[model samples]
Target: MIGTAKYLFGLSVGLIALLCFAAGAVIDRRPDVPRAPPPDAQEVRAALGFGQMALILMGTSSPVSFTLPQAWLDGVHSLVSHGKDNLAMDGRIDGRGAVFRVSKRLTRHGWLNLAFRLEETSAGGAPRLILYAGGWRAPEWLTAALLRMGLPLLGGSQELESLIPAFRAEDQTVQMTARVPRALVGGLQAVLGSGEGGGVDLELVRAIYGELLAGAVLEPEPDYARIVRRAAMQVDSAEGLKAALVALTMFTDGPRVLRLAGDRTKTPPCALTAFATRLHGRADTPKHWVLSAALTMFMDEKTGRAIGLWKELDDSLPGGSGFSFVDLAADMAGVRIGKAARDGTDIDKVIAGLRSGRPEIILPSAVLQLPEALPHHQWKRRYGPLEERRMMRQERLIGNLLDRSPLYSRLPPSRP
Candidate 1:
């Protein structure tokens, strides 16, 4: 009986061990590995061409990081060697890296300006690029170009939302900056949590931008004083204040608040009446208290305190580093204040000059220095380098077209 018992026990143990081994093997062979991107390899290769262009415009040292499959880099190389529709300044490959410039026609205005550098995976296992925001004027346009090339910003896609938590680093805050309304509170909370001395909550700032883009009509709570005090506590740092200015000035309607032409098609204005009104004199508020005041004036168009507030802001707010929020606001307000002869000519300047209550028919200036058209064949001879040559050629062509086209003549010239 004892011998029989021992044999049965030993057999049971052996069976259990075999079952464990089989289960381990099945798990090992499971198809659950992380994928790089869009299922089509060919598409990824095609995207490399555009990615290469974005890399040059943004730069190798940019704060924004991107990781692409090695295959994408290989494909970009193939295009550079053969593609004729490529940019005048074709991308150059360096060991495990690439650099290039990209230019695009801005209708009759001018070509889009950009340059960048790209590198293989960093220690974080993704390619990285640096954007000199100081020089980067049209971020939205640049972002669109990158998206066309299959490179979206981090935490930028809805399909990738579930995977976001896994991808986020320990210290990284949840980024909610998209044209989504649900993320506003979460973003606000993050910014407020940063406190007086903490780093600016960039993620939160992005959330605000998302709200603006969606043309959110924020209805303030009954306790206006409490909310305003809370906002003051949340955005105490200079960096935080700057972040607010950036988010606010880059209005959802477009770059500038005012419409260039008098179409009377206005975007539904952001509802800031309550918050701005309440925030007027809250203690320990942002140094640029006028920011809130300005918001109220923008939405209400009262101009009661707006004109005086503008003077104070224009005098106090420092300039000369990057795109100015003051300039953006001024344009939106349609208040032109340059030299007498140089009021309105280029569509951009005209857009800037158009202020609230100003007449729309400002004439083109007499000193209008339109670009000189040069023939394509003489591109290399007249322009010294690749960058200069391409820029000059495009400008000249645009200038000649402007001079000849009836559209240019229809535009009103500067008065007096």
Candidate 2:
């Protein structure tokens, strides 16, 4: 009876060891694949269906596998909170790999589709987050053309930022009976809300938006229009920027692409800067993680100086609040922040690590936000103050650009 019991116990222990070995083998056998490059806009549009736009690619590495579904869901929720879309997933797992489907509205009549997948692939031998979107292709050329035509709107470039402010009509203290397309609301808001009885009155703001639109005197620039249309058709190739002029064009011309890029301004718009700063002082309202991460990255990039891209990012939140350049470029691009928790990682360190060793920091080419453009040459090669001459050029350039706005003369000077 004792001998029989011993044999049974040894058999049970062997079975357990076998199960462990199998599980370990399953976990370790991810493919040795490399990360994919940024998909060509035309190709991505084709694959995801052309009706959708905006691609977010995140990349990271970890010895332990993540709960990918949870991470993806968290990402989607974050985006939706920032008004990307109310997204749902339809997915399935096959041996060692999985795929997810995501969709959203791009316009009243148009919808966008996307596909998300997880794989053991790396870019330059590092893991990457792969996202694909479908919609009307608004390429860099189109943005540049629009800018030259005085649209003051550019999207889909990490080097440029959006200048268009978002409109929140429902938040108005005083309600107006008429309803305008949500697309047109932002321009109208910008026009109406320039400066009123006091600071940030929504009703007064709406009124200001209307007055500015009505007061503008505009003329046709055939050359600018021709360039824009051509660029829209051949977005992948257009590089040099033609001079886009400032004219109050009707927002009703076509679908208003809310994702816009700002001109090369060295500082954030003063109003935005002040608004973000005020949030820091409010005890009732906790600062957002995106804002916190951006501020942290901005400070690190500025070398502890309270200036540069971080300040601009803080101020620009009103135009498209709730999204962070760091989130889009790094975390969403797949650098697992949580994985580095034991490495004493924080937002500042993560940003510093990513920006280091690269000739230029590359940001995700999403709508509304992009990394502040770096100088073409060796950025670190400067004497005294790094990039001082370039900084002067950017400041002058932005000043001239802002001066051209119809609302510029009426708006109170942004805090210097």
Candidate 3:
């Protein structure tokens, strides 16, 4: 009887251990593990091609890092070499399927642009982005090209690098400014601007780039800002300057841009309203004050003083965001949907009659996302990367939009 009891206890303990392991498998969901992008293995090999040039390239920024283990280094080196070996500046990535020649249309912009190299996959297969080299500096010619052809800034200083575990030390906040050749940058710009067919952001990209990326303060240099802002205008083919002017009309007494735009066409008051509302203020609330303001604004904490939250700006504000900062407000011409669903209105069809724009779709898809018991932002600070922080902020912005819109209940909270 004693031996049987001991055996039973041992089995129970083992079962508990297995359950804990299973729970861990469920919870330890990192993006990289599941969303590992397919690399063009052959193209990777070509990118690494360097018969004679290999010796000279060593002294520069070593891709070698202590953080990156040895075996991995050998693998990546193999990949880079594959491209360098078989490929030339003009060679097609997968010559059999579709050749990815650098577009001449992009060349005029100069060197300070991310050279997006296209690699050929199997025949009829989608092209894969294999080479993320070049685009570190802009030459005089490239700058001139931008001026002449109107290619403005796209990537900011903060985004010069990204999360490359193999090349970086411990993964905190380090922008691995790729030390690619200035000429290489210029070459890429030429290819992209050449416009034969390089899939760069040909249109104005209104992405809200954040500064917390490098954990460093970006000195106020209006040159890049001006370039980017103007580029944003150029991409949409709508005058961003004019959009700014149109947005400024919101403050004026008469009907705003949305109101006037909605007058002739089926643009939603909210569609134009979002653009006008974006002009409200550059609402850069600090982290702590955001908490206080939330308690005040939503929780009805009279002392919360969300209005005062704007007053207490900490750390010079890492790119202020508001409820309605539409990076693409200029693009909101007409709605393209048939039936409206938000707050039970035909706003979708109304907007569709006006313009054909893709609507923003939001989803959580995580069980943890549903649980509001723990403060997510706080959790992110404790263990999240800068990207996670930005994601959380974006989630908050989406929530704010829903709360304001008549579409809160219409949005399905949970997805299968």
Candidate 4:
């Protein structure tokens, strides 16, 4: 009787293990990953043009509404996801709310899927977001409990409701309406618009290209300061000048900018191709580093994406030089310069300072004093991502240095 009991017990244990494994297998089915298509130059240009137009329209007091097609959303998703193929998103509007489905592929086999609906509910006569229909491959009670715990940790629904005033999802398109501050609208207009009208001036763009070609022949080195000065000089209006400054940032770091834009065939004539070659050489200068930061900032703004996160990840990995505050300074300086271009508050002073051919005019020499690199562990311990205190201190120091400098002071105030 004892022997028979032991055999039955062993069989029951094995059956339980088998059942657990089968359950995992059911949840972990192979994920179907979609490949991102290559970017088309025409589509990119059109999108930029439309964005610029939308900024101009938003300058008015009235609310602005725009519809984004599924293709554009897919492209944006691919871009934000870094084309990892490990994650995907699908969203649509159902009735008064919107539903978003997100899926992540597991390392070995299955996909972890979560679907949620966002519906606006009235709370004390104000609109607020209520998350509904949220679940994954978990029990209903467990999923609900997890969502309830996670929502507050992710800034609650208040943040989402504030950011998205009105949203409508459809099978093929998503329409959104937003109200932007006048200051932001004015700044965008100053940088993106032509004084004669709302949209960018074709003549100004042609002149910029013309100047680039002319500079290539006239100057042996890719002197960006000279190019920017000359481009700014051609346009009489403040808006035109600001537009030129912002546009010229693309060529400042030509190689990386081209790569980011998916333009492999065409190269700017202003020794951009040669300059790209020189960047990898031993003779590269601090100016090159500063220009690269500026290009990164410009690209970030243009695409509404953050490439710096990728840079930080790459630097933090094994065999890398780690994080560098000097790089941070350069990034801050580049962002300040971009802001100046957009504000156009001191356009004359900016133009005058650029002609001096001194990189210190933009990136202060004080930045060289900062620590070169810190390993991932040290960086995490000392200064983690989005750490408010460290960021505020750094911004204050950089702001003070830029404000004290004659060249940077000529531009608008650096508001962090």
Query: What's model 1's overall lDDT?
Result: 0.31
Q: Which prediction has more favorable TM-score, 2 or 4?
A: 4
Error (Å) of candidate 2 at residue 15 is 57
- Candidate 3 lDDT over residue span 170-199, tens digit each: 222111222333223444333222211122
| Candidate 4: residue pairs that collide | 28-110, 93-169
TM-score for each candidate, following the candidate numbering: 0.19, 0.20, 0.20, 0.44
Residue 79 shift from truth in candidate 2, angstroms: 6.4
Task: Choose the strongest candidate by lDDT.
Answer: 4
Please, what's the RMSD in Å of model 1? 23.0
Highest TM-score model number: 4
Predictions in order: lDDT: 0.31, 0.26, 0.25, 0.47
- Model 4 regions lying over 4 Å from their true place: 1-198, 222-227, 255-314, 319-321, 410-416
Query: In what order do the candidates fall by lDDT, top score first?
Result: 4, 1, 2, 3
Model 4 TM: 0.44
Ten residues in sequence with the least summed lDDT for candidate 1: 168-177
Q: Which residue ranges in model 3 land beyond 4 Å of their true spot?
A: 1-34, 37-178, 186-377, 380-416
Candidate 2 backbone clash number: 33
